[model samples]
Target chain A: MLSIQNLHVQVEEKEILKGINLEVKPGELHVIMGRNGTGKSTLANVLAGRDKYTVPQGNITFNNESLLDKTPEDRACSGLFLSFQYPVAIPGVNNMYFLKAAVNAIRKSRGQDEMDAIDFLAMVREKLKEVALDESFIHRPVNDGFSGGEKKRNEILQMITLEPQLSILDETDSGLDIDALKIVAQGVNDYRSPERSFILITHYQRILNYMQPDFVHVLMNGKLVKSGTMELANELEEKGYSWIEKELTAAD
Target chain B: MENEIIKKSIAEEYKYGFETKVAQDTFPPGLDEGVIRALSDIKGEPEWLLEWRLKAYHHWLNMKEPTWAKVHYPPIDYQSISYYSAPKKKTLNSLDEVDPEILDTYNKLGIPLDEQKMLAGVAVDAVFDSVSVATTFKDTLKKAGVIFCSFSEAVKDHPELVQKYLGSVVPYTDNFYATLNSAVFSDGSFVYIPKGVRCPMELSTYFRINAANTGQFERTLIVADEGSHVSYLEGCTAPMRDENQLHAAVVELVALGNAEIKYSTVQNWYPGDKEGKGGIYNFVTKRGACRGDKSKISWTQVETGSAITWKYPSCILQGNDSVGEFYSVALTNNFQQADTGTKMIHLGKNTKSTIISKGISAGKGQQTYRGEVKIMKSAENSRNFSQCDSILIGDECGAHTFPYIDVRNSTAQMEHEATTSNIGEDQLFYCNQRGISTEDAVSLIVNGFCKEVFKELPMEFAVEAQKLMEVSLEGAVG
Candidate 1:
């Protein structure tokens, strides 16, 4: 469903993502693990079409269509979703209203009838339960004054509601308590199907313990250095990315 | 379909341009004692009122046009404009008898004169050019012990009330525009809520500028008696013209002991095109006086259309424990310029005030927020809080803030906060990833910025104000 070939990216003339090559087929769960500043977040941002990351070379394709040329919104309508590392707090915009607008925009692009307010509310309420978010959160401003755990859960709630074809969860487990993490993982696990795919980007393997991945990739120095089964996550957790860095240095 | 499209295009081009072709009684273009006398005589004012007009006329001659505002335009040709113009031989007894051309102008402006289409139980006083064309629900208001009519009619019928509160808050020499408005003002709504009476419905006045080469100067005075409450709304629009028209208006409110008055304005004048050729220059002075113990006054406005707008609706808290508030959302697009905010003067013990202002500048427009908060020596333990935020759509436009705070009492607590920022690329990108368009994202962010102020409006008006913001910010993003 998603393919990247030698994705070279930069920010302010400094290379961030150096020749990243990855592919995720339908129903596959791929996890990318890296230390802080090892280009984990930069890769997610590039896939989501953030403007700050300059793509120097290479190409990305989604569903056999060129994804690099599409706008971020067009990418979203094409069934791509990015759970931000830090959710933005938009004061005065109700979370429900934002969700409705987003859903309608995607649905309209897909030639579906827009949902009415009542139906939209009903639909989001069921999704909120999956993430253990309270109904009161719907009426409040999006993420304004929200606690750290609440913000992460809210992101998962949106991911559930959007039901994207390729979902990229960037640090969704950070700042979440044990219960919140389980709920977030449950929301992600429930959405796992043969027709949908996900890319989990995180530093810790704690969340991987809840929902296992089909494949694990270690990113270091703007490049994916190794790939293996879920057991690689436990190996990296025991021996940190320093071992991976040494391996890359020696291989070079 | 062709006609509908043409009409829609016209509506979009000149949102407020509709003319009334009534035979108008206009004086020669000039400003002098003779013009004041002519206006006074035309209204058949009593002796004392005529004397008041003459006094104001002389006081206006010595005063200079105010230059402190951030608005700059060519000096008004006061000498080449008529001071009085009224529909000829029109003794308007009912809305049906109002001139068709005048009614059409109102219809085009989206103010239906037909009572059936208006908000249920609410009243409207429609003013075209320089006179009140029709005032609905007057009888019902009178039954509730409310005196709602034109200022000219009030001068003749309720002289004592008009004289007592006309310039009580904003005197003749208060400022340059007020002085001019006090001198040659034609007509405006006069509202008097009796003691302990809560007004049953919202009182609104719609002011339209129609005649060519004419300046609109109207004065509004609303007094809420002891323990009474009232909410007054003012709306203004003008036709599309290549020459900027001068509009100088004065509005004053008086709230006695335990009374409250809320004033709102939705100003949609003809904002000049991209090149800034012609539009209305709206210069207005609005103030409210909290005269007795525990009185309160608040001002809210949404300004979206104008070439140059210079107005500051203010409050004077002279009563112990009185409260004052000002919530504003000023938007400027396509060469529009607005310098607006408020003033709060605390004179009595333990008075309080709050101010929230939001300025949105897009499409080469310039917007500025200017305000003042002053606490006098008598105001012991007075408190104030102010927050001003500005959002710039494009790099070409400018956003500015000028705040003045003065506290004479040592016990006064005053706090002011302000922020100026452009829409960040990250915020846009975040929304874009949610499948929302860039334009919708801008609208959402701008709406969030002004939500603090927009929520203060009434429910219906809050929705209208949101749509107005979207329209004002159109074509602002690349």
Candidate 2:
């Protein structure tokens, strides 16, 4: 469903992602693990079409179409979703209202009939239960004064509602407690289907226990240094990233 | 050659020059006591009203235009423009008899003047140029001990009330524009809520400037007696014109002890074109006074129009424990300029006031926040809180803040906070990464910046203000 060939990205004139190549087929769960400032989030941002990052030397294709030329919203309409590390607080915009606008925007781009408020509300109610969020959350301003756990759960809620073909979860488990992590993982697990794919980016290996990944890629200093199966997550968790750093330095 | 320069300057006045073809009754351009007398005579006003206009005219002549505001403009040629112009229509005794052309004009301006449908619960006093065209829901309002009508009609029917409150809070010499408004001011709305009476519905007035070579001068007065409460709304829009038309209006509100008055203004006058051609010069003076203990007054405004807008709706807390508030969202795009804020004067014991201002400047527009908070010695234990935020969309635009805080009473507590920031590429990218467009992201961030003020508006108006923000910030994002 997604392919990145030699992706080299720069933000503010500083190269953040260098020579990244990855591929994910439908129904595949790929996990990217890295230390802080190792370009894990940068790859997610590039895939989501953030404008601040310049793809200096790379081509990204989603479902056989070049993704670099599309806007973020266009990418979303093409079924690409990003779960932000820190959700934005859009004050004065009701959560339900924003969700409706997002849904309508994407639906309009796809030439589908828009969902009315009543139907949209009914649709979101079922998704909210999957995330265990209260109905009152729909009436409040989006993420305004929301707790950290609530923000992460709200991100998952959006991922569920949009039902994107490819979902990128960037640091979704960073601030979550044990309960929140399980709930977030449950939300992600429920949406796993043969036609959909996910790229989970995280700093820890604990989230992999809840929703196992088909492939685990270790990123270091803007490049992927290692790729393996779910066992690689446990290996790294036991030995830590210093071993990876040593391996890279020795190879250099 | 000087005539060419003057004509160029005059053409530059109106930024929006979209005209609506309609016939109007306009007097020859000039201002004097004779002009004022002719205005009263044309309306068939009572002799007392004629005397009152003459008095105000004499006082206005002796007063000078104020220059204290942080605004600079060419000197107004008050004597060179007509002050009174009303569309030539049959004297309609009812809404059904109103002229279709005038009704079409209002419809074009988004004001459905139909009495039975569009304006069902809304009591509308439609002011076209210099005259009141129609007032709906008067009978309904009268049944609730509320009086809503045009200022001219108030002068005739409720002469005693008009005589008692006219110039009470904002006298003729209050300021430059107020002085000019006092002299040869055509017409506006006047509302009165009887003592202990709560108005049933919102009272609204739509003002439109339709005549060419004429400056619109309207005066609005709203008084809520003791234990009474009322919410009043005013909106203004002008047809596209090439010449910068002058709009100098004066609005005064009086709230007696235990009364509350909420005044809101949505000003969408014709802002000049992209290059800053002709537009409305909206210079207005609005003030409210809390005259009794425990009274309250609030002002909320959404200003998205005008080539140059200069206004500061203020409040004076005179009664013990009285409260005052001002919430505003001002946007200036293209070549538009706006210098607006509010003043709160605490004169009573335990008085309180709050001011929240949000300013958005896009393109080459200039937006400023000028406000003042004064706590007198008599205002023991008074409190004040002020928050001002400015967001700039482009590098060429400018945002300024000038806050004056005066606290004479050591026991009074006052806090002021201000922030100025541009829409950073990082924030935009962040929203974009979340699948929101750049325009929607800008609107979201701007709305967040104005959330502190938007929450102060009533429920329905809060929604309206958000939509207004979206409209004002159109095409502002890359």
Candidate 3:
């Protein structure tokens, strides 16, 4: 459903993503693991069409259409969702109102009728349960004064509510506690279907322990150096990423 | 890329900028004792009222225009402006007798002068350039013992009430603009609710300026007698022009013992173009007084248009246990400037006041919130709460706040809070990624910022205020 081929990205004259490539079909979950400052988040941001990160050379296709020319809002209306690492705090816009606006905006672009207010509220409340957030969370301002874990959970709540075709979670599990991590993983797992796809950008394999992925890739210094199955994550968890760097050095 | 969207949106023209075609009787473009006397004569005013106008005119000649507001403009030549312009067809006994062209103007403005087709529960007084052409539901108001008519008609019908309440709240010598308004005021609505009576319908006035090079000076007075209650609303708009037009108005309200008066305004005069070439110089003075025990007065305004707006709708809490409230949302876009707020004076024991003001600036617009809260020694246990918040959309815009407080009584309590915030790029990106356009995102953020003050408006007005805000902030996001 999505393809990125020979993608080279830069920000402010500094290359962040060296010629890298990946592909995923429908219903597939792919995990990108990397250390800090290793172009992991850059790949996610570029995929979501952030203007700060420029694509120097390469093409990204969603549903066989070029995504480079689409605006971030248009990309989102076309069913691409990115759960931010640090969710922004919009002071006076409540979570329920923001979600309804987002949902109706996308629905209108898709030529669908606006969701009824009562039905929308019911759907949102049900999604709140999967994220382990109480009813009061929907009434509060979006992400304002939320604890680190609650903010992460709020991101998950939005992900499930939007119900995008391709979802990208950028370190959503970083600040989450163990219990919150399980809840987030369960929410993602429940949202997984044959028609949807997922790209999880994270540093650790703890979240992967609860949810299975079809493919695992390791990125280092603006390039993906390794690709394997779930067992690679288990091995990396044991010996760390230095083992792969040593292997690459030996081959060089 | 988003900057391109902002520029494109800002290019949209003002919606209500069309002029009407009609024959008009306009005065010569100058102001003197002869002009004032001629204006008073044309209106057929009584001797005493004419003397009052002469007195105000003499006082205005000696007073200079105040330059302390946070605004800049070319010096105004008062003599270059015509004092009066009215439709040639005068003296309408009913809506049917009104000129069809004028009716068509009101229809295009979405205000039907015909009572049957008008918005239910609203009695409108459609005021053209220099006259109140028609006031709907007058018979019904009269049956309820409510006096709702043009100021000229009130001067001829209920002279005692007009004489007793005129200049009681805001005297003619109060300020520069107010004195000028009093000297040559044309026509506006006058309302009076009787003792222990509640007005059945909402009273409203729609002011429009059509004649070129002519100033619009309207005076509004409302009085609620003992134990009476009334709610009044005013709306204004002007046709776009290449030269600035002066609009100086005076509004005074008085509430007696146990009476309550709620006044709301939606001022949408024609703001100048993006280059700041032409628009309305809206200098207005509005104030209310709680004159007797347990009386209340509230002012709520949504000011979204004008090249330069300098106004302060204040309240004097005079009677013991009286209350006053002010809620305002003023927005400036595309080179517009506004300096507006309210003043609350406490002179009675246990009096209370609340002030909530919101300012939004975008597209090189500038705004200021200047308010004062004063407590006199006679006010033994008075209290006041004030909050002012401003949101700036672009880097070129500005927002300023100046709050003054004085307390002569140690027992009086005052609370003040202020905040200024910018619409950041991060916030815009967040909303854009959520599938909302940049324009809609800006509107959402701004509406959220002004939600506190918007709730104070009437139900119908709140919706219109939101839509007006959306239109005014179209190009604000950068």
The top-ranked prediction according to DockQ is 3
Q: Please list the C-alpha lDDT of all candidates, in the order they appear.
A: 0.87, 0.86, 0.91
Per-residue C-alpha lDDT of model 2 across residues B1-478, encoded as one tens digit per residue: 1122122321123322345566788999998878888898988888876776777778877778777655566787887899899878754368876677878777766665787665447788999889888998878888998999989889878989988998899987677678878877888999999999999988899998888889999999999999999989888888776678899999989999999999988888988777787789999999999999999999999998898999999999999999999999999887889999999999999999999999998877898899999999999999999999898886778999999999999999989998888776666665665567777887888887887777777676678778877876676665
Specify the CAPRI tier of model 1: acceptable
What class would a CAPRI assessor give candidate 3's docking?
medium
- Model 3 chain B: worst 10 consecutive residues (lDDT sum): B3-12
Winner of 1 and 3 under lDDT: 3
| Top candidate by lDDT | 3
Off by over 4 Å in 2: A12-16, A136-140, A240-252, B1-18, B45-64, B90-92, B424-426, B448-463
lDDT of 3 by residue, B1-478 (tens): 4455456545337888999998999998999999999999998999988999899999998999999999999999999999999999885579987889989988887786788896667899988998999999989999999999999999989999999989888898989999999899998889999999999988999999999999999999999999999999888988999999999999999999999999999999999888888999999999999999999999999999899999999989999999999999999998899999999999989999999999998888999999999999999999999999998876678999999999999999999999998887778888888998878888888888888888887888899889989887766664
Estimate, for each residue in A76-143, the C-alpha lDDT of model 2 and write its tens digit.
Answer: 98999999988877655788877887887788888999999999999999999999988999898888
Preferred candidate (TM-score higher): 1 or 2: 1
Q: What are the TM-scores, per candidate, against the unseen true structure?
A: 0.94, 0.91, 0.97
How does residue A65 of candidate 3 score in lDDT?
96
* lDDT tens digits by residue: candidate 3, A66-126: 9999989999999999999888988888888998999999999999999988999999989
Which is the better candidate, 2 or 3, if ranked by lDDT?
A: 3
Task: Give the docking tier of candidate 2.
Answer: acceptable
